[model samples]
Target: MKKQLSKIIKLILLTCLIFTSMITQPATADIASGAKIFEIHCAGCHENGGNIVRRGKTLKKKALKKYGMDSLEAISAIVTNGKNNMSAYKDRLTTEQIQDVSAYVLEQAEKDWR
Candidate 1:
């Protein structure tokens, strides 16, 4: 019993240490990557940071109003499958890129919209 308890304590401590290190590192948000992808690709249709009146609806207010999802998941699905007049991006973007870009859109909306 003592040996088993000791091993469990050590495992917990090691796990905590690993988690602390990960948290301490300068972690970048996936949104940053998504923003880059959007700037390069989606910006053409949707416009960067803000939405376009000519082509598509603005993502800022409309997204929160229409979909109760987080900006990240919303953007990823839009990028992957598209909606309405928008074209799907599953063939063009990788899963990692989609997640990153989704995050990026939220960041952009935050920075540019408000």
Candidate 2:
């Protein structure tokens, strides 16, 4: 009976560990798909993170920070809903795609679009 209890305890601990690991793992956005989407849809106006239509509203780090768009949530919202001259992409892109693109934009902005 003691041996059976020990085995059960070990199984429970192992299950807990697995569950914890899964729960604690961070969700990552697909940057590659984001790059492709950007290339196809955004590059014309925002090549290399520079905004052609609105020079002051570029996607560079400084512009993003100055405009309060440095976070993924802000960027994702803008991309999803559009702002000012920017066209809304909700009909053209999925939520996952928007997330991926937003992550990609942030990553690029962080890198100064180099």
Q: Pick by TM-score: which candidate is best? A: 2
Q: Which stretches of candidate 1 lie over 4 Å from their true place?
A: 1-29, 53-56, 67-70
lDDT of 1 at 85: 75
The TM-score measured for candidate 2 stands at 0.77
TM per candidate: 0.60, 0.77
* Backbone Cα, N, C clashes tallied per candidate: 4, 0
lDDT of 2 by residue, 5-109 (tens): 999999999999999999865368999999999999899999999999999999999999999999988998999999999999999999999989999999999
Candidate 2: worst-modelled 10 consecutive residues by lDDT: 21-30
Q: After superposition, how far is residue 113 of candidate 2 from its true place, in Å?
A: 0.4
The alpha-carbon lDDT assigned to residue 56 of candidate 2 equals: 91
- Residue 10, candidate 1: C-alpha displacement in angstroms: 18
lDDT of 1 by residue, 1-68 (tens): 99999999999999999999998653355766666787788787667544564433566645644565
* lDDT values, one for every candidate: 0.70, 0.94
